[model samples]
Target: MLKERVINETVPIQKIYDEEIMKAHFSSETLPSVPLVYKIQPGSNQARKNLTPTLPSSSSFDIPDAYQSTNSDETFLIYDKLVSCKKRVLIFASPK
Candidate 1:
């Protein structure tokens, strides 16, 4: 499994779900309209790292995973926000 971290300034959830941001990953044909979103509580679970590669002698390793407003209607249509850190994750909405 891959691991990512989210930190720094917290952004409002609404802005994170913008269409322009999601368009590349989800075309209208692929994304569900008004997908469900569950708010995850900020806690230690987020702190859990499955694996962190040991660095030789790095001073700073503060970068966190991409923080995203996730879709949670038992669907794959995921909308996340990443500015400059352009790595993207695509989730296709599940069929009901």
Candidate 2:
């Protein structure tokens, strides 16, 4: 006589549906509401003094001879040279 063979196998898996679960847990009607308000105080009449003291009203302000230069006219000349040079490239970078 021939004997029959039998096989049994099982595989288990768990999946989480985040959107459906969140939708069931949270709703607009269940959330709490709070009112927000802000108020500003009035300033006092006392005048604030500068941290760095200013020069006397009678004294005339003058730039130091060493720091002054005729570079203002040369700025356009340098710009023109940069424009003429095809190999040159200008790039400006700023955080803002």
Candidate 3:
């Protein structure tokens, strides 16, 4: 049986001020200046000639027989049972 690991585990909650830190770092005085003028260059014919369009050799969607499960109802029933059991345990542990 798979144990309820979440009940046993302790998750460390972190207080992050990422947005505030980013805003301070990217303030006007520290920000990079953009160039007023720009230059453009034409693509070389040799670079274009070296490139080729590619298509998948075999475009197929196939599912193996082993992967297809016939016990979906049983799977869902087990999941439902586990969820209910966990809820009961939590309610029992909590003080009203």
Model 1 C-alpha lDDT per residue in residues 14-93, reported as the tens digit of each score: 34434333654777776675443334323313534323335535333333243223233253445433434545444444
* TM-score of model 3 vs. true structure: 0.15
Top candidate (lDDT): 1
Please list the residue runs of candidate 2 whose C-alpha ends up more than 4 Å from where it truly belongs after superposition.
Answer: 1-84
Q: Which ten residues in a row have the lowest lDDT in candidate 3?
A: 34-43
Cα deviation at 62, candidate 2, in Å, is 39
> Which has the better TM-score: candidate 2, or candidate 3?
3
lDDT per residue as tens, model 3, 24-83 = 566576544521111111122222323423443432323332223232312211111224
> Distance (Å) between predicted and true CA of 1, model 3?
41
After superposition, the stretches of candidate 3 with alpha carbons farther than 4 Å from their true spots are 1-24, 34-55, 61-96
How do these models rank on lDDT, best leading? 1, 3, 2
